[model samples]
Target: MKLKFSEGVFECIENPPQFFASLGNLHDATIISVARTAPGGVCFIIGDVFNNFVDFPEYPGEFGAAIILAGSTDCEWTVSASHLFGKKINDFEVFPAHSADAKYRLEIACHAMDRYVMNFDKAEIRIAR
Candidate 1:
């Protein structure tokens, strides 16, 4: 199954929440695949990290991730990696495109003790299949 994010909305590609045991916490190690839509939206393909693990704050257990899209002028977004599981991973916020006709850059800001990590990804709006 896949989780899709587009046009400020999130939904599962296939199957339902019952397919997974539970949504794990954030801060867990996970890989997310992002795709750019034609109309300026973003699609994320999040896969499982473990085969039988579930819940948050448990090491080596498999859990999903949460994506919080923020429109911050300060150039940072926050993600709670420790609270991922049984929930949709796609989160989005509206932002200005780099250019009038170009795709919008989705900025991610992860907060740490002293500083933050800034990452940029772009997306377009479209229907999910």
Candidate 2:
């Protein structure tokens, strides 16, 4: 499916790993941490090695990238977002235009062969490290 992010960023992914890595040209993305915010918000940390590309920054090393996930008004989670690490993104829809404070509209979605599901209303991806 097509992954639509803010700022006219859009790309097609052939696999789950490619989906995350393709976010803003991120490389070697690995879930470093996950946390809860607000009343029911979750933050998924994806670490990436940046600045090695030709157009990237001078520094080259691993840094903490941000993928903040939250809900509009009390988001629900059938499965913890933290446990999604290494799970295949079977399918997902990221409405960047409607996403605000991490708002991501859903129409029946799950990743990792239906092993995990997090109802998020807000989502933001920061590829730069």
Candidate 3:
């Protein structure tokens, strides 16, 4: 019932739109639990947040948090959990490890100020002049 916050998680908030790179950053965290953000964004509760809550039957896993590579340097992440994610808790001992890994989905939140992202793909088509 004691899960400590590893330092790297801070990047999730500090970096903005960039992912926390390296699995070890999460303490080799097996599960990347997800929550839908109130602002159409997303939130992730990393690592064994469930070990303490499973018996009560709650909280969420990983097929993983997928990394969306934008061009060459930008990256975004996504999350997907099993039906049992927030329900039965851990995967059955009889089964191979299925959930409990780091992975994610991609959502590009181009807010009111990102002029570059908002127009990065636009083109002015014109006949040869």
Using lDDT as the measure, the top candidate is 2
Task: Record all residue pairs in model 2 with backbone atoms less than 3 Å apart, i.e. clashing.
Answer: 102-121, 102-122, 102-123, 103-121, 103-122, 103-123, 104-121
List where candidate 2 sits over 4 angstroms from the true fold: 1-28, 49-63, 72-82, 85-103, 106-115, 125-128
Each prediction's whole-model lDDT (CA): 0.32, 0.45, 0.25
Model 3 / residue 22 / CA error / Å: 7.0
Candidate with the larger lDDT of 1 and 3: 1
Point to the candidate with the largest TM-score: 2
| Per-residue alpha-carbon lDDT of candidate 1 for residues 1-129, written as tens digits (9 for 90 to 100) | 233334335433232122232322122223354433443333334444332234423434333332322221233324343332233332222334565443233332212321122223332222222
Scored against the true structure, residue 38 in model 3 reaches a CA lDDT of: 36
43-117, model 2: which lDDT tens digit per residue? Answer: 555555342232555544445545555564434456666665643333343333244444344321333433333
Order the numbered candidates by lDDT, best leading: 2, 1, 3
The whole-model C-alpha lDDT of candidate 1 against the native structure comes to 0.32
Evaluated at residue 39, the lDDT of candidate 1 is: 35
Candidates in descending TM-score order? 2, 1, 3
